[model samples]
Target: MTELVRMTGIEKRFPGVHALKQAQFDLKRGEVHALMGENGAGKSTLMKILSGIYRPDDGTVEIDGQPIELSGPKAAQAHGIGIIHQELSLMNDLTVGQNILIGKEPRRSFGRLDERELNRQAGELLGSMHMKLDPKTIVAELTIARQQMIEIAKALSNRSRILIMDEPTAALTDAEVSELFAIIGRLKSEGVGIIYISHKMDELKRIADRVTVMRDGEYVVTVEAADTPVSTIISMMVGRALKEETVTIPDLDTAETALSVRGLNRGRVIRDVSFEVRHGEILGFAGLMGAGRTEVARAIFGADPKDSGEVFVHGKPVSIGTPKDAVRAGIGYLSEDRKHFGLALGMDVRANIAMASLGQFTDMAGRLDEKAMQATANDYIERLAIRTPDDRQEVQLLSGGNQQKVVIAKWLLRDCDILIFDEPTRGIDVGAKGEIYRLLAALAADGKAIIVISSELPEILRVSHRIAVMCEGRLTGILPGGAGTTQEEIMHLATLRDAMTEEHA
Candidate 1:
């Protein structure tokens, strides 16, 4: 009901990019105010300024109608501000209690860690949120969802009155999201002002009181959550409307099987996962995160070592122990994390495109044919409609969707017959999502065996010819993709097996 935090005329600039321009944001006490924008829209930049991660070139910050200067994160923390970053900042080797209550450990007289007392404090903090994680459990051994919970616990330990959550539900399951929402509601009741940033529209309607949309580093509009339509919000955030429609899948019933995996196993992530993908089929692997979908693809593409598995390409068994073998077998893998695994961020688009199949563009003298490589990259760039100032630009400078196109271009240029796309549309805008979907459909139509791994149930239903769901380390069931399939049905199979069921199986 009262103003808890406000930033007026906030401006931040990087080397050549004006990241934020006079952005205005205000959060009321006990309210969840959502910050909406596409990637590079300055949502994170603006919030970082507020959290003292960056010093704004120009701005005025006010808390409780009083102007305040935030010199650093410590200052922000002193002012009751806490931020849960998009990426988990936990030390993998540390225990949950140690990470959550870092630097604030209760010491007993001497310099001892006071292990029992530390866990007791941590347990109380988790208990407040109804979390059952043991404080002494190693963070490395925890699931992504559990790690996220620990992040939240760490934030709450600060006794923060203003919480900034960036894409909090990015890795959470439906059930876990619900649990988080419950905690958020409790925080709201306790008069905690929350700044929530997410691309998920449905969540805003459920949790947010007000919505603020930004586009092109400028604040667009602010509207009450109850009154604004999701479509209107999306249009404002992306500067355009997106028609959500299913991609057109070509007829591939008679296409020959392109890839066949038999008894695939990678530790406990994947177990006996066997499937066949036809040349013109888009086989979708649908499940919750850590359901072995990505693992299966990585193992097949030889990104990860297979404990035991056999891969067959076009009816012939292929020995794939490394990525080189997979590439020779005409297989290409598009990693889920584009920034880390998919592309070389430091290299130009043409170089990255030619990376996978450099031999094709190399002369007998072992020197690269720059002109030929540029021509090839340019052709695919134009064909895929990749938006870039020039093909010479670095792939990292491109937008999320455009970077994904570059990754796809690299594989396609390598003449890979079987392609695996993992979370291809993640961090991509809605309009670009459609473009990527169309690209995938066209690739399938051209007889490229396609395996798509996605967490979005709607994506799986729309683009897949056949759907496979994994639970724990096992492939539980497969469904015919169409109108008959539902998200609930997929989730049922995704979490079907527990320890007891695994023993029985």
Candidate 2:
């Protein structure tokens, strides 16, 4: 293996923070190098510098033993460097071929796009990766996995010698992840250097050749993946030893039903879903993406209208047609896409937290009680351990984990008995995820009926009192709270989404 990329003495600074401090990174051809760290640890910042999105205040980047300056994104692309961001960056209305070959399309002599050639080339690229999809297919028509495959194809199309993937498997299913690993194996065999940035420790052990740990904007150490234990990696990344333990609460077997849905139906998204959540239970909805887990939650919370379903609270039938109706019925929903749906990003933390319960603070004359709202928001900020300078700070400025806490705080302040959390830990860091888990555990112990929908099997297993698996809009199976339920069981249900057998029917 030869050094394909070397970045030394990288230093970046903001107004009050050293975003990166003398950080160093190295990548070798034909190897998968993993960068591990918590959120705000400056992993992304360092990679941005590599991709020419940012110029380091101080550093030297050497490629093939020659120092090179990356002035911009185009320069990086010309140098055979490419990055696939954590969020998919595709135009939904465009065709797959257009997205893959954007900016560098094949053109005819007249300078017009040669559509046939473009499609043929894109199809070949997909075929090479063992992906079965039409290049002419609209991006919106593809699954998340297929879209990710298109992203990879786009990178390869750019003749990327050094590829950077940030949380590439975050939204993928087990089968999709396996396919991605196969593609990675092929890339490695072809001597393509890959920089994998992920919080998933297990993935590093499975795929990476070496692991580079970063903490608080500084490189801590680098070690062979096979020789280093996950515990060692975690300690290096966080600058402290962190415990990996599951927190369990006592069984709430005899608790009253907080929310019950009978025959919940929402077109093709949710079908004949029926479940009951008891008070003090963290009932987890486990399945792959597009499994209707989030759809079920939306229907139950009245974020979307269901075709037919009966919702009950304390055995009393309730009519919930909208979010207001759900709230009136003592239900609150935290959408998975918190930035877009759950929170008003531009609003201050105090405003977001008090948004749901504003009416409670209004007097008989319709006068707003600013003092009461501030006090309430301040209380939740302290209790949730939200890392914000002040409640007056905008939610957008806070980290992903803190923003999620604000959403949770809003619902908690509203006194909602049935809480629906959809991918509550998505985009959250490892350390922050643990804190959120602990908070959820405490909430369940306090007798809140919690329905947690998560794509991460480990998170679902660690947090839930019981696990319910959904496949293609149907509830396939429900398992007990304890260690009997495994990731394999959930995956089995996730993949069995085509159709139910006659016996099952």
Cα lDDT tens digits, model 1, 408-450, are 9999998899999988887675667788888888888888989
Query: How close is every model to the real structure, measured as TM-score?
Result: 0.89, 0.90
Candidate 1, residue 43: CA error in Å? 1.3
Kindly list the per-residue Cα lDDT of model 2 for residues 258-308, writing each as its tens digit.
Answer: 988889898988988888889999998887778899888888778878999
Candidate 1: which stretches are off by over 4 Å? 343-355, 358-403, 498-505
Q: What is the lDDT of residue 371 in candidate 2?
A: 88
In candidate 1, position 37 carries an lDDT of 84
lDDT against the true structure, per candidate, is 0.86, 0.86
